[model samples]
Target: MVRNKLILAAAMLSSAALAAPAAAQNEQFIPILSYRTGAYAVNGVPYANGVADYYSLINERDGGINGVKLLVEECETGYATDKGVECYERLKGKGPTGAAFINPLSTGITFALTEKTTTDKIPIITMGYGRADSKNGAVFAYNFPLLGTYWSAADIAIQHIAKEVGGFDKLKGKKISLLYHDSPYGKEPIPMLQVLAKKYGFEFTPIPVTHPGVEQKSQWLAIRQNRPDYVLVWGWGVMNGTAVKEAAAVAYPRDKMIGVWWSGAEPDVTPAGDQAVGYKSLMLQHGAGKFLVHADIEKYVYARDKGASEPGKVGEVLYNRGMVNAMLGVEAIRKAQEKFGKKPLTGEQVRWGLENLNLSDARIKELGFEGMLKPIRISCSDHEGARDGRVQQWDGKGWKVISDWYTANQSETEPLVEEVSGKYAAEKNVKPRDCSKES
Candidate 1:
C-alpha cells in the first residue's frame, strides 16, 4: 500500500511540473478595439472584421506563434476617443504580453491612443488615418501609420491633376475646392493641399461639410456658385454618399470630382449607385476589388466560413482595406517573431517588429495578398513603409487604377511632419529620441 501511494504521488508531481511550463508559455494577449455600431459604422465594421479575422487565422492556422496562442479580446469603443481610452485601460492588464498591439480604426482614437501608447509600450497600428506626422517614428515611437498619410494622399491627388492639366505651370489660376467633413480627420489634408496650390499657382477653396454630412444644401450651393474646376471630397460613412449625391445634383462633372480613398468606398458609392459613375478618388494603394489577393481571401477565409465578421463583404473596397490592415498587423507580428524568437512577445518587441517590417512582392503573393499592401520598410525614424500611393476611378460597377505609385513632394511634407510632430512632442513635454544610428 505504501509503494502504491508513492507511485501516485510521483505521477501527480510530474503532471504539476508539466502544467507549470505550459502556463508559463501562454502569456500573449492581443486586444482589438472595434466600433461596429457608430457614426462611421459603414467603414469601421468591415475594417474591424478584417483585423479580428487575421488574428483568428493566425491562431487557428499557425498554432499561435511559437506555442503562445494569440488571445484577442474585443472591446467596443463606438469610435469614440473616450471609449477607446477606456478600452485600452481595460485590456492593458490581460497578460504578460500586455496588449501586444492595438489597431484603433478611428483617427480620433488613434490620436487619443498615441498619447498613452508610449507609456504602455503597446504600439498603436494606425494603418491609414491618424496624425500624419506620427509616421516620424522618432517623434511618435509607439505609433505606426504604416501605409502613408493624408498629406501623402493629398500630394498624390495634386500630382495626378497636374499631369492631367499638361503641366504644373498650366494649373495657374485654376480653382480647386476641398469639400471636407468638418473634423480633424477631414481637415488633415488641407495644409498639404494648400502647400501644393501655392507651389503650382492654383486657387484653393475650402468648403466645410458637417459631420454625418446629410444636410448639405449650403455646401452644394456654395460649390455651384463657386464653380470650382476640381472638387476634392474628404469624408466618411454616409457623408460620402451625401457628398456624391450633392455633387451630382449640382451637375458637377463626375470625373472632375475626386475623393479621398475613404470617401469613395462601396458603401459610399453603392448608396449613390449610377450617379457616382466616373468619380475619381486617390487610392492609398489598393481600391475596389480587382487584385488577385481578393480572390485568395474569397477562397481561403470566406470560403471556409472563417471571415473577420460579415461574410458578405469579403471583396468590397473597404473590406479589402480591412484585409490590408490585417496583413500589416500580422506581418509586423511575424517580423517580431523573427527577432523575439516567437510568441508571448512584449509590446516593445512587437514595436521593433513593426518599425522594421519588410514585406517583399513575392512574400505578399505567398500570403494571398499581392497588390493589397505595398512593400513597406519601417525604421526607428520612419514608421511609414510606402509613402507613395495611386489614383483610382469608379466606373459605375467597380474601380480601376488610373495612376501608378507617386511619392508626394517630400520637400513640401517632411518639414510639416517635423514641425507638427515637434509641437506635439513639446506640448507633451516629451523629447523625441534621435534615431539616426538606428536609421
Candidate 2:
C-alpha cells in the first residue's frame, strides 16, 4: 500500500512540473468593446466579426505576433457610453499582458475613456472617430486616432468637393449643409468645417438629428427647402439608412450627398435600395472587398470553422475596417516585441510601438494590405499618422472607389488641432509631453 501511494504521488508531481511552463507562457490580451446588440447591431455585428476574425487569423496562422498568442475577450457595450465604460473597467486587467490597448470604436466612449486610459497607462485607439484634438499627441499621449480624425475626414471631403466644383475658388458663394447627429460624435466636424467655410467663402449650415436618427423628417424637409449644393452627413447605425431614405424622399440628388466613413457601410445603404447609388463617403485607407489578407483569413480562420462572422459577409466595408483596426493593433504589438523582447508587453510598451509605427509601402505590401491601405508612419507629435483618405460611392451592389486618394493638408488642420488641444491641456492642468525628449 505504501509503495502504491508513493508511485501515484510521483506521477502527480511529474504532471505538474510539465504543466507549469505551458501555463506561464505569455499572451497578448486585447479587449474588444463591441456593440453587437441594440440599435447599432446592424452596423456593429460586421465590425465586431472583422476585429475578432483578424485576431483569430493571426493566432491560427502565424501563432500570433512572434509566437505570443493573442487573447481577445468581447464585452458588449450596446452602443451606450455607460455600458462601454463598464465593459472597459471589467476587461482592462485580464490576460498575461493586461489589455494592451483598446479600440473604443465609438466617439462617445472614446471621450469617456480618454481620462481613464491616460491614468491607467493604456492606449485608446479611436481610429477615424473621437476628439479631433486628440491628434495632438503631446497633450493626449494615450489617444491614437491612427488612420484619420473627423477633422481630417472633413478636410478631405472638402477637397473632394472642391475638385467636383472646379477648384477651391469655385467654392466661393456656394452653400453646404451638415446634417449631423445631435451628439458629440456628430458635432466633431463643425469646428473644422467652420474653419474651411471661412477660408473658402462657402455658406455653412449646421443641422442636428437626435440619436438613433430614425426620425429625421423635419431635417430632410429643411434640406429640401434650402436645396444646399452639397449635404454632408455625420450619422451612424439606423440613422444612416434613415438619412439616405429621407434624402431620397425629398428627391435630393444622391450624388450630391456625402457621408462620413461611418455613414457609408452596408447597413447604411442596403435599406435605401437603388436610391443610395452614387452616395459617396470618405474611405479611411480602405473601402471594401477581398484583399490579400482575406485569402489567409478564409483559409486559416473560416476553413477551420473559427470565423467570428458569416463567411459571406467577410469583406464588407465595416468588416474590412475592423480587420484593419485589428491589424494595426497586432502590428503595434509586433513592433513592441522587437524592442521589449518577444513576450507579452505592458500597455506602456505598446504605446511606444504605436508612436514609432512605420507601415511603409513595402511593409504594407508584405502584410498583404498592398492597395487596401495607404502607408502610415506615426510619430510622437503626430498620432493621427496619415491624414489621407479616398472617396467611395455605393453602386447598388458594392462600394466602388470614386476618387483618387486625397491627403488632408496638415497646413490647414494642424493649427486647429494645436489650439484645441492646448486649450484642453490648460483646462485639465495637463502638461503636453516634449517629443524632443521622448526617444
Model 1 spans > 4 angstroms off:
1-27, 290-300
- Per-residue alpha-carbon lDDT of candidate 2 for residues 204-297, written as tens digits (9 for 90 to 100): 9999999889899999999999999999999999999998999999999989999999988988999999989889898987988998999999
TM-score for every candidate vs. truth?
0.90, 0.94
Q: Largest lDDT belongs to which candidate?
A: 2
Q: Total clashing residue pairs per candidate?
A: 0, 0
Please give the distance, in angstroms, between residue 203's alpha carbon in candidate 2 and its true position after superposition: 0.7
TM-score (C-alpha) between model 2 and the true structure: 0.94
lDDT of each: 0.78, 0.89
